[model samples]
Target: MGPLPLNYRRPEYVSEEDSRQEENSADFYDKVDASLQSGPSGTSTGIPDALTFDKIINGGTCPPCTVRDFMNYLIYIEHAAENLQFHLWYRDYVKRFDAAPASEIALSPEWTQTMEEDTIAKIQKDAADKAKKVSPIAREIFRGTDFEKAPEIRVESRDPFSTPPRSSSGDSVSLSGSQATTYVSQEGDAFFAAGVKQPFTIQPFRSEINRVIATYIVDDSPRQLNLSAREQKAVVRALSYTTHPSALRTLSQNIENTLRRQAHPNFIRWTICNGNPARVTFARGLGVGTILVAMTGSIILTLSKAGRGWRALFAILWVIGIATLITAAKGMCVVLHGLHHRHVRPWELFIDDNATGIEQLCEGKRSFDSFDSCNSYEDEPWVVRYQRRFYVRKVFDRQVWIQEPVLRQIQDTIFLQSMLLALLGGGTLTAIFLAVPAGNFF
Candidate 1:
């Protein structure tokens, strides 16, 4: 593994008198040196276990750390595994056939030559791309080639997960140094993609993981990039995917120093609002229309009668317009959020907020999962943090968007009452204005 940057912990505060005494004493200096060499206290200072899937998924024990962070955590592991897989594939298949006669190989000599050239070129390209830290696989995936398929996996005879290679005398040596690990060492469930099961456990070597952290976090991160608690949580999650049993021992000190020392990202970074474009467009248009209608109603009151009925009606319209405007600006068709038919942004750790808000607006009622009504998400696990996201989609019971829900979903009895309230409020204000003639006030 590469040597990491030295990590210095933020020391506990001491009185100036004590500080001066410590500086004057050789004992204090010896204690400081000892602590530095031994590392800081706590389990965090040790190498975290790398074989548990749940450990990787749980992005550390911090609030706002989420599954979205977990996916970001997967990038390094996936790339490291991908590159290693490709190299192993070449070694086991093509290189093994290199010394054989052309006739002995299954493919034609010309075909074999093409395979060798292509694999070599790809390997070179992969190495060059790694200099930037982020994986080049994404760039390659869009080109739509064989790489779009899950990278092929093959364990070497030397790999801990693989069966030992047979000796000339036909004995298999399962025990090799400290790597007396079998495929079962990766005793975890497999990942599922497109309803198909994949068997190879996704893991990154400790060294590769360290390099990634150093490249992105310590040495090459943009100066303005501030690492927050959420980001720190992500790094912790990433460590859990390392193939090395004691990965944290090798990487945690560097991880902590890098995240702490790095400057924070700016308030407005590259952010994508995940929503159905069609729904967002519709909501915006409706919001504009509602605002216009509110303005028109206000204008009409200026010209028309100040009777109680007219005043009452316009006040209701005004309220509808305001609610509609707010709903649209949020990229939320109140209907879509209620129906659980919406795209979730990576930052959207809580979907229940929408449900609770909508039910309040639509029915003036509360939800069973409302924080005030139920136990709140105070310090639950990351999985529990993720649960809110999934629970937002629990729509079987909601009455707001019954059947083919749409932007018109809010047009229920409560909707009508809101319109009436807007009209009443608008008309009453108009009557008050009419009572105090504008010419006299001017």
Candidate 2:
């Protein structure tokens, strides 16, 4: 199986009218229509046609978007995040499958059950015997090794920057705050590290395949995909024959296209709406207040018996006020521009226990627990928490800072425009005041 036919329709969903048509109607579920492409009605999302699905998903030099970013949009903004989740997992799975020894890729069907059981028993006994050979201290040292253990299944935590799980030695292992601890068998790690690959063939890969099936392919799995019943059964049957990644090739193709065509475009629109750099409500209000004060002061100075020189000095205040107002109008902040970061919006954080706005975009109410099943930040690397200590009000107000390059450029442009406007406006006002005779207004 490969990509779904351009006009493919699930058998159960195909109506009599659809079956009679030359081209079957495209499945509408789990998809946004042309009118609902972006956001709320009458809101200008301004999604560019040039920002193609590939560009949004893969990203380019300027946009600073990536697959991870797209997944983030899917999780918080759009629904049906499982497609991308399975797509990503399948990609990694294929790479590992390709690397496995060709001879051991699939188990022998000709082997009797007894023979298979005996072979597995022998391998286990060998592993146990080898483990006993190492001294207790050496075993402890190898067990304490942090570098090569396989990544753990990600736990859903609201805080992406939370600390890693403590080591078994009771030592606080701060390898990176983002990494979760995985407890792999020490004997297996030791064997693999010592250049002795595990002797059992296909069992490990088969076990992994079963786990994937149970997690994402089964009908009631936590992150069950939007695949039709036929598609799901085909995948299960294919994997039963061989644990090769090619078994999932068709499913991967379908999911990849879904993400590229549907999820990617939606993600671009979402980014346009929310990803732009800007000042918060408080900052914008401050700018407005400053403008009012400056206008009042200018009026008072003009009405007084002050000299032209003293009035001219007020040009500085006019410049500051105008610049602040301009920046606010553009939804940019001068201070944030200097800092080179933007605050993550409330919706982006998904702070509400039930993810308040997600359900409004579609019809159904998704459980909160399931929302964490396909998290985008699951295995992201640890970075310096630059915004960790930065806060305005810790309890009621939490600011999460992300350094977005495209948004930084937008901020820079806004800063320049504001300054230019401020300078021009201030200069014109100052020139008029200078030309006016002193005490005329008084």
lDDT of 2 by residue, 354-433 (tens): 33566444312232222334444433221123234234441223343434454444345556767878989988887777
lDDT of 1 by residue, 392-432 (tens): 34322222212212112222322333345555655666466
lDDT value for model 2? 0.49
Candidate 1, run of 10 with poorest lDDT: 263-272
Error of 2 at 353 (Å): 21
Specify the highest-TM-score model's number: 2
Candidate 2 regions exceeding 4 Å error are: 1-84, 104-204, 226-247, 250-279, 298-332, 341-414, 421-442
Measured by lDDT, the strongest candidate is 2
